[model samples]
Target: MEYTLSPSVTIINNRQVLVSSSSPSPANDRRRRRRRRRSNGILHFPFVFSGLSLRFRSRAVVVAGAGSYGGYGSGGGSYCEFSCLNTPIEPATPAGRYLSSVLLNERKLFHDAVAETLEKLVKEVDEAYARKALTVDSSEAALHRRIAELKQQECKTSVEDVMYMLIFYKFSELRVHLVPPLSKCIYNNRLEILPSKDWELESIHSFEILEMIKEYLTFVIGWRSDFSVTESWATTKIKQANLCHIYTTSILFGYFLKSTTLRHQLEMSLADPIDDIIMNAYICRRKNLVFGHTHNKIPTSPFDGKRERENLVSYLTGFTSDSLAKCAQPNSKEALNLITKYSFALFGDVGSDKMISTSFATLKRLVLEAVAFGSFLWDSEEYVKTVYNLEEIN
Candidate 1:
């Protein structure tokens, strides 16, 4: 049997290779030019290949195009189809554009950027771990030292690091769904439940805050769950220590644990079975903590970080005005009712918790705390620090 093949085009890393008939037709050339003109600005590429004789192989020459797209996971190859897009594409935001540039670069700029940040965080965590190691007895100290050693080896490219990168990418998709009001509400509420501790107030990248919360939540979940049944003592200890590192990393990075409440679903998706156990325990222990909700609808416009900041600022203005009015009439039934509802919204139905009662005095104090938290949310800096827990970049 004999077979004939039509001309095709394959591009690898933006370099175009054209496969065509030895006797090229003027019609084909015109068609190719028209196709290229139509396919502008779209990333979708179709793959096509056909077999031919060595005689025709000589015609399979490379053609340099004026423009090209760059990315991974196309079997290291692609074929651009210059056809009208079936659906309109969403517009790009500044952050999305920046991420796309970093990601599509052949020089691996994105990986390097993330690696630099991850390394610094790991080093600080290692030093903290080392200090704790010295305070323990010889046997315990040896175990701690071993754990530190393992962490040094694994910290830069750990599963968490990969997951962090994934979360960063996912941010582009979820940016529209990032509910600042609810995020702020949940974050502040969770922090109020913690033991008395002073958090350093500093601005950090929004995604940095999200990643830190995720790491902390994963650690919290991992710490409470028992691993002795199936895993060795060293494995369990090391796992717990990693979680501790993540927790301390959150603190050291100056990332507020409260911010994760809005993005907890993303954290849950990235968590392992052991991490899930910890999350489940938290839910069982505190049934009413409302993490912000999400929906599946995609937005028409790209997520504008600037617009988000502006909206959050606008929302905080209204939140403060309303909250203050209620605070002014502290003794009114309306005030009491307002605090009770706000408390329930933030902390969930705390009816079971012995420490948190519904008394007027208790509710009043909670109302005041909400005012303080509202202030905290409004004090955000214009730009996020590249490295949290580090000196603010000018």
Candidate 2:
């Protein structure tokens, strides 16, 4: 398929979402044309919208003019569509016109930007596996080969995808989910996502994971103009744009973890039932997903490696979110882009400087949801690619 990028269009989730008023203001029209503002791969909508989103995400991946992804089966129920959409899609304070604006060539920009960031990060990670490799190319090849040829067996996937998963393994080391006693019903007699008040934060990643987080903190957050990140990131007012950046990257982080964990499980599952004990041990739980008051609807973390595969498979077979279908598909490319780009729209104008001074406790839920969002995206992108051309299809 062939597509064109237009400076006049707003591309959300890889689909063009054109927003225009039925009528144009004579005063505004009379104004002289000016150069469009530079965009940082984030779009800003100035007017009121019921939340104008151009992407569609349901229970499973659907590849139409949009795309559909096949979900994995976990012997469990489905999650609420876009349960990961923790915030509204409006600007923080609103500033910029939609037309006459362009994204910073996110497709090519993403790869180059990540390569530059990873250049500084690769040194801190344990490269005993790569024989002291320092650049992304050498380290990526060695790491991808290791995952593909585990236990003397082979699996096939793009080296780029594998590289992303491996790069993130060390850069961050945290995940979030709600504690047990997930109540399915509330005073309104409807299913609602539990608030951050009930969240449980865990930092039990491997020694390597923690070290990577440290390296990233120093490289990325150690010198920010907005706020500071100490050994413990204290509760302070933070820039919405920065939070949006973190939000987008966290999704990629979890998505990579989910993908790597699933591939690793495929290799280990065939080796020995005894090996399962260590690899498949419980990780963390994601508070995203809607349950039918059933005991098994809760989803296991992708890191768990024991049930995410099964959970994803079940979604393919028959899991669904009817009324919410258009709003979710946590496992699809559209959903991935939808959630990732959401950061650009959440506060102020596109890349607005306004800060979301909300309590740290309240924002934690959104942060965790972003990670869980990526995990599901991996499942969607992973399974959908088997039948669809896949690879973000941009």
Candidate 3:
């Protein structure tokens, strides 16, 4: 039926029949008067009012249309109607509600908590380490003594602790001028935190270390290839441990990158050599440690695996604040530590410790040497990926 809403307004159903006349009846006139009183009066457009439904729910006008027609009437007049919705509807999705909540928080309650949290964590670790180191004089001295003691005692060590001790021990020979030693570089000497460009870019002349690393990289490139090498059993064991250190360090570095603002800033500031340093670190730390124990042969030693889960946490807790401070800076120490623990947990589940205390002790020294050599590419004069070039920083 054709419903003629007003003189200009008309709505046709499937059957061609007039529902209302052009001249208004008393009831229609009253409806028009009531609509005219409302601010949401019907628009005078034939196409708009044809199949459209405008709902006035809670005094607000809402326009809803099914379809539109091609042309207007003979008089070139178009009209629209604003109908009332008896029942108000809630939105189907929580997106609108969420947006409102976000808006509210943004206006009054939003606060960034990362920086403060990181600072707190770093302080805690530093204090703990400071306290712990008192037994052996300085932290570095104590660390070195501990390394020596561990070697003598035949005790196992965490990859991180072993890495730290090895790096500290090699600082002098590595030709890197670490200001205030480990203490200066770790906390705040952002300007000279890492080794100079020359120390990093030097070509690795250590063929034995290079050969081991190269062989491992080759194996990694062809990971699908059957794991068989013609090297001596001793060499094979060394390679396996080296591979584990590489994997462990790479994973840790990645975590550090994501966790800490300082590390991220360092990456941003010295883009070229910094990335190279991290990449080299990754390459150095690369071990055959896979995530899930899906393979036939385990990549890392049981000792390394145990260290990842059990000893690593204990080791970290000893200097947790310091390490966290280095990475998270003003925020996210607990968050980062939680992430580390979770990652370590995953590693523990997937890997087994095959490395003996002696083997574990020996590999750190090897890894230190390998890392120093491998990371030398960053010191090359020609390498120039830096923030100065991008004008991100002066």
Candidate 4:
């Protein structure tokens, strides 16, 4: 039997030996060498003495280093050096996009959880209200108890904790669903809640609604610019120590009108009172008015500096009109001077408890003082005449 070595094999022999074996009848020796090489050194031939020729003898003596083969060298030697032929391998399937999809799924799950909690709260409140209304008893003691229990339970469980649990569970579910290629693609893809084209209109509508709500809030908290003694005392000394509350209420009313068709109409109404004050002062200044003069001329007096100046001018003008100019005067300057002299006697009077009591009494009286004054002014011309008479008498 014969075995053929693979093409990977290479054979080499000494050139000197080949030339020595190429003498007469060299063909037979060459044939034997070829046969031996082809058979992978398995064929063994004993040397023949009679037929021994120099060529045959030379060929039979194998050179030690020259005899080497490439294919799977003998058992203990290195294996054959074959060309590396790489077979085609498929590319790895991607999992990056699927990760984002899983995250989105988790977000949706948590959102649903929060929504569920809000819905439950709404339902509980509604049910409690319904139960209270259905009861025929005058007092809703049982309903109150049930509501208290529900509130306690809800207070113990935070909305954030519920959302976190939902997110955990949803992530697990997403991982399971993403086993297939289609599921992975669907989950990872970006999902938009609203279409792009409708966004502008939606934004405009939202702003309009917000403006309407703000207007409604302003209307519910009304405003008054004219401060009443009663309102001031009630707010500062009795009810609460906050001036901002009254100021904010007044500003809100002004802003509320700006949102309506009544804006210009209200502005016209406000201009009347402002014009009255400015016009009266301008007319008085133009007339070169000199009022009465009242002075205590005492350094120890604690009268307000501004109030004293005002009183001095008032008295001096009265004196100029009555004595120097001989104009129609309201009353006697001596009596007015006497009244001004005694004004300092009204200070440093009340104790702490007395002050508080007086403040409370003053607040009560002032509560309806503005309304009464307005009523008196509107009712009759005689009322105004009486006020002028009283001023003249004083």
Query: TM-score for every candidate vs. truth?
Result: 0.17, 0.31, 0.16, 0.15
* Model 1 C-alpha lDDT per residue in residues 177-293, reported as the tens digit of each score: 111111122221221111111121112224433343322222222211222423211211112112122222222122112322222432333334434554554433222111112
Give lDDT for model 3.
Answer: 0.26
lDDT of 3 at 116: 26
The Cα local distance difference test for each model comes to: 0.27, 0.32, 0.26, 0.24
Please name the candidate that would achieve the greatest lDDT relative to the true structure. Answer: 2
Tens digits of per-residue lDDT for model 3, 1-394: 1111111212333311111223112443565446435824222212111232111112222212211111121123321111111001111223222322332344222112212222333444455545555656654776655555443222111211222222222332334321221111111111111212332312322333233333222222111112232210112121222233343332232233233322332333333442355444433332211111121111232233222332222322343343542431212222222223322321222134333211222222323333442232111100111100111110
The TM-score between candidate 1 and the true structure equals 0.17
Candidates arranged by TM-score, highest first: 2, 1, 3, 4
Query: Against the true structure, whose TM-score is highest?
Result: 2
**Model 4, which residues run further than 4 Å from truth?**
1-107, 136-140, 155-160, 163-394
How far is each candidate from the true structure, as Cα RMSD in Å?
30.1, 23.7, 35.3, 53.6
Q: Tell me the spans in candidate 3 whose CA falls farther than 4 Å from its real position.
A: 1-111, 119-246, 252-342, 350-394
| lDDT, model 4 | 0.24
137-194: candidate 2 lDDT, tens digit per residue = 7747766556434511211122223222222222222222221111111112112233
